[model samples]
Target: MRKIAFIAFGIALWIFLTPTLEIEVLLTALIASYVAARLVGNVKLRPMKILNFTVLLAYNFLVAVWQSLKIVLGLFDYESKYFEEPAGRDFLEKFEKIVLITLTPFTIVVDEKENVLIIHELKRRKGTE
Candidate 1:
């Protein structure tokens, strides 16, 4: 069931990413999705959780972009910070978190050591600073 869900999700994602909807494209999507699902192994798919995560990611992306613009316009300061990764997460989950962190313009996972992620962040400058 999990594999089936992953395949379906992959196909949907491929279709959403591709501009064309030809037969060849669909066949490729099916094949690629199947291969990807097989390679990814078991992954539970929770639709509501996924939806919430996607929404949060989009919101963070927009906020990051705004913060980046502010930094570039000299209205903000930048700093490096460390984020502690949650314990007991699998490799795929960790990779997903890393990708999510790196996707934002104002924050990047620059390095990882042990269970910590080294992130660079942009911040609003304090008036006293």
Candidate 2:
């Protein structure tokens, strides 16, 4: 039910935002989920539950890496790439900003009992694995 509402909202938002919306309905939906989670409470993702997010995160990162590689190659062929002019300096700058923003990890901690959202840094170990 929550997911369905979110999807619908995203479609509406994408329609609202239109073509320039780089992420389209999906990003809108994801953002909606984050917002909803926050509104209700900090959503909890236990270690086991974390696996549920692994795939989507992995896919996003993989696509970002692939696009980054393409962007690199595009830069090399800037003189003849894009069928227009290849992505210009502005495009690269904007893309870098988007990727950097989108990929940064934000941990969502949920107060299950109170239904409140808390965003925090994901802790990392200093020692080697």
**Predictions in order: lDDT:** 0.72, 0.43
Candidate 2 segments whose C-alpha is farther than 4 A from its true place: 1-49, 75-101, 104-129
Error of 2 at 27 (Å): 35
Cα lDDT tens digits for candidate 1, 1-129:
888878787787678657799999999999999998888786667788666656666677677778768768977555555555552267756766876777776667877787777777655446535
Error of 1 at 83 (Å): 5.4
- How many clashes (backbone N, Cα, C below 3 Å) per candidate? 0, 7
Tell me the lDDT of candidate 1.
0.72
TM-score of each: 0.64, 0.25
Which candidate should be chosen as best, given TM-score against the real structure?
1
- Poorest lDDT segment (10 consecutive residues) of candidate 1: 79-88
Give the total clashing residue pairs for model 2: 7
